[model samples]
Target: MAMIEISGLLLLLLTIFLAGGVWIAISLMACGWVAMQFVAGGIPAGAVLATTIWGNSASWTLAALPLFIWMGEILYRTKLSEEMFRGLAPWLNWLPGRLMHVNVLACGIFGSVSGSSAATCATVAKIALPELKKRGYDEKLALGSLAGAGTLGILIPPSITMVVYAVAANVSIIQIFLAGFLPGLLVMVLYSGYIIVWHMLNPDKSPPPEPAMPFRQKLKESAQLIPCMLLIALVFLSLLLGWATATECAAWGVLGSFGIAWWSGTLTKEAFWQSVMGTTRITCMIMLILAGASFMSTSMAYTGIPLALAAWVDSLHLSPYALIAALTVMYIVLGTALDGISMIVLTTAIVIPMIKSAGFDLVWFGIFLVLIVEMAEVSPPVGFNLFVLQTMSGKDSNTVALAALPFFFLLVAAVAIITIFPQIVMILPEMAFPPQ
Candidate 1:
């Protein structure tokens, strides 16, 4: 069979399974089974499936996922979001956007710890929306900024999405983490810059400025943030400075999160068990997806699908930029229906080879992939962040999605900026681990 035919067949099977409401991991596994049974003769599909799952599951580096997730889960149950708002509001009121910047800053901070976009969106929005409403901020802008900035959960260091991408792409988890740092900050700047520009143009939309705070008062107000800041510093610096592996840092982050939660007096027995249960559920889901994806990748390798697809793409004689443009569009379409991790796992097997053939660095492409996935988080229908904000604000999905539209474009702008200046994604990684 032709590669295109096989590709079409697999795609059809996947669509059928998913549209039939099969779980994503099972759908992926089913697709792999069909591919191996009919497309790749004599491959011993059952043995391959068992071994592939075991190998993917037993990965030492993959251990970081659950620990980081548990860390986020622990912090999620704390009063951190309320404290964060109190601490950050005084500092941000002087900005043109005033307290609206809290959504962006708070999401970035909380995301560093949480690593889950929905959790970050939900956690920050829980505190930010009511406060923004009380302060007479524009509802659309408050919702929009929170929806947009909430994606920082995946872009910042200790991102769950980054871990899945790095493991799938067979790259350094730390390098991918480092690579994401600047791009994440770039998105924050873009979101905040948009807020500032919007406020300046429509000054009446912002509430009257609060009274100025004395420096000591400002410092005192921000004191609650020290533990969170220290936790971020410890995990990030350990990764950047080579003091620990990603998994080690995650373990330390988990310990640090427990300490912070205890200090905040929110680490009750119930909260601890809830955090553990949340981590278990999330980790099990992700690992199942990873296992299924690994098997499918192996099956595709046996059938030569990825290489053939790469060759077909190569035959198009498209420029590197053109290929990237095509991929960006493809991912955007995928984002409307799939969550971020699903988008990454389903495509990376086929996409990474094409990327390497185009002479693009995998680490850079991982960051690019993440930025595109971030855009997906705000997209309608299946956009998780949109759903999060809608639930919090008691708005319909359309209103929440419309509010997020500008940030969606900002994410597009972010993608373009990184594509044009690839150095932004590469600088930190290169600085931390220069090529020999």
Candidate 2:
């Protein structure tokens, strides 16, 4: 009877999601309330609901999101993207994919310092897209590459998503970072592989420069990129070596990014003001969604919906693999309607507990979850990356959407590697973590 009721409640929730005329949080709350009516006889909905909603919102770790976002905004508004590319272009500029390679690599480097994927996509695209188009590169490659590569921002260290995951699951954030490194590199290499292989197969599609620069010139040009690399290292140490909390580490990155610009004579008062304004705007948007998600998750727990669903799933006795597979599919679906951060909030809250209850390592599972969430950020039907790419380039949105398909598959494979080989995700953190 519990199984039958759980099935009925799941269907009702699905109907609310698919009903098409309401906000997701509203729908979630409505469905959750309905579940309460069916499943819980004793609790007061309003009291339980308020407590659940406000409970997680009060976590101090959430402060990192807005701070990290502000850091990325400062970088973007200060034209760090321009500096990043100008610095790296010399070394990578002669390759077949040429500037596209620099674009991807620059985003990858920026990813090390900034934890916001949309900001990485928007900031990189805003600076690089026009220049790539001018150099006669394929629009598909230009936009698709930016959108896909930007996904790395969250998977690499200084990742806001990982911090939230650590807070949510009570795991070490350092462990999350160490585990994230290999998969992040794996994704980068795969993206580079796509660029190289795609150009190799279709030379016409990815044009080369008329006169490639000499190796020495390229080497000299790359000298400019060294400062940015140093910035990445300093920020990484602050957070990873226990010198700073994620928020303080992000503060260091924000100051350092601005300091470099000022010292280099690129950061003017005008630029600084613009950076602060942009940071304020973007940070507010993120925090609002996070707050709403907190409330909605609260409602779900208060309403007894999670308990109802968990009880139903437990009775099934399904293999862990099957359960995980279903959850991934649901994430892909939710990805269409939700931004990566919001998706993580809603899904991870509901699902992570279930996976842990089923005996999966939260550490390993967190890596898998983060990578998958990154993939959703770049996917179509609501991919924030796609919109950012389109807005930056003012070109074919459809083409960018289609081009991102290959990288999406690459993400699937990466998730599979982490899923099947939990050691791949755990080894670094296990080795790097200070004895606690």
TM-score of each: 0.99, 0.87
Q: Which stretches of candidate 2 lie over 4 Å from their true place?
A: 1-55, 93-96, 209-216, 295-299, 302-304, 434-436
lDDT for model 1? 0.93
lDDT by residue (1-436, candidate 2, tens digit) is 5545664665567456756766555655565565555555565666765776677567666667666766666666667677778777767755667677877788888888777788788777877877887778887777778888998888888787887677656677667777888888888888888888888788887655657678887667667577778888887776556788766777777788878787667778888787678767765655554554555565556555566567667778878888888888888887876667667766655676578767887878888888878878877777888888777667676777887888888889887777787777777777766346
What lDDT score belongs to each candidate, Candidate 1 first? 0.93, 0.73
Q: Candidate 1's residue-wise lDDT over 81-162, tens digit each?
A: 6787789989887789888898999999999999999999999999988888998999999999989999999999899999
Candidate 1: Cα lDDT at 72: 95
Q: Model 1 residue 82 lDDT?
A: 76
Task: Score candidate 2 by lDDT.
Answer: 0.73
TM-score of 2: 0.87
